[model samples]
Target: MLRSLLPIVEHAVKGPVWDCQMCGQCVLHETGMTCPMTCPKTLRNGPCGGVAVDGACEVKPEMQCVWVKANHRAENLPLLPQSWRDEIGHLRAPVNNSLAGDSSWMNLVSGADRKTPTGWKGSE
Candidate 1:
């Protein structure tokens, strides 16, 4: 019951605020509270080297690059802790497609996001 409702509630809260894609393993804290999944290219690591001089996204000239916003917020957001600001440069794990639409809250409690996904090492 709760397992089914978690995703719905999570989406309801995160969707409009972060343009959440329900990637299930959220790195918002790591990425300055910005959702990299919302990027047009969904480039998890960083920008695609196409950011304009004015800080606009290459894919969408009018929109600011997600990484740019992430880095800026990571550094300048007064509410963020020093540790979170320092984490913007860390390399993040690739998206776990199997976890899509699942509840990250549950994954965090279960430590499911920490374990290597099945078949990532070898046959499950």
Candidate 2:
């Protein structure tokens, strides 16, 4: 089924393009397809406010700031659902490593996961 094939396909396609870590809770749609793994701080929302003048990452100056690009991209798209828009910085849940490299779509289908934003925490 399509759910079973999602992991393999995403790893192949998004892995190289986005440096995806296969965290099994894809936020690409909310993030303008920008992978948070690309951020040195692993920030899921937006930039850390330390971006360089050219919109380069502060932690890795040579790289473009993903959040900046995501913000810009969001502007041109149709309005997202209020929840998605409200979750710009707060929606990221802790990655469940038990599900790493698996199908997040399947997780959603099984009610094991959701795209809804959750509170940040230091430990489970």
Candidate 3:
């Protein structure tokens, strides 16, 4: 219903600044709003071994690695949990287009087609 329309608005708002890939597992809350999809390697856990001298991404030398920036921000933000600083890992799996324009928040809450987090809710 109304929640379904929220994505259309969120996509319009968050897409530009965040380069939102619409991964369906939005990690913005975990990553200081730096979209993990911006990582060329899509490395969710952290920077790959090849982070450059200036902390730029190895895969995309011109750009800063999102994880490095996320770690820094995570440290300063009071509400962000300490565990998020160490909790880098793969985000579910790549989502298909069928979920392209949906509300990830609602999907996660409803447990519709979403993949549960590992070790969450007794998942293996």
Local accuracy by lDDT, each model: 0.87, 0.73, 0.69
Indicate the TM-score of model 1: 0.89
Of 2 and 3, the candidate ahead on TM-score is 2
| Model 3, runs deviating above 4 Å | 1-4, 78-98, 112-114, 117-124
Question: Cα deviation in Å at residue 89, candidate 2?
Answer: 5.2
Instruction: For candidate 2, give the lDDT.
Output: 0.73
Q: Write the per-residue lDDT of candidate 2 for residues 11-92, one digit (tens) a residue.
A: 8887888788887777777776677767888787578989998999998888888888877665555666655544555546
* Candidate 3 per-residue C-alpha lDDT over 1-124 given as tens digits, one digit per residue, 9 for 90 to 100: 7676878777888888878877666767767657777788876666788888789988777888778887777667677666774444334444444665677666677775456446455314
- The candidate, 1 or 3, that scores higher on TM-score is 1
Clashing pairs in 3: 45-88
Q: Which predicted model would earn the best lDDT?
A: 1
Could you arrange the candidates by lDDT from highest to lowest? 1, 2, 3
Q: Estimate candidate 1's alpha-carbon lDDT, on a 0 to 1 scale.
A: 0.87
- How well does each candidate superpose onto the true structure, as a TM-score? 0.89, 0.70, 0.69
lDDT of 3 at 89: 39
Residue-level lDDT tens digits of model 1 in 22-121:
9888889889899999899998887888999999999989899999999988888878988888877876666878889999999999987666645555
Worst 10 residues of 2 by lDDT: 115-124
- Which candidate leads the pack in TM-score? 1
By lDDT, the better pick of 2 and 3 is 2
How much is 72 displaced in model 1, in angstroms? Answer: 0.5
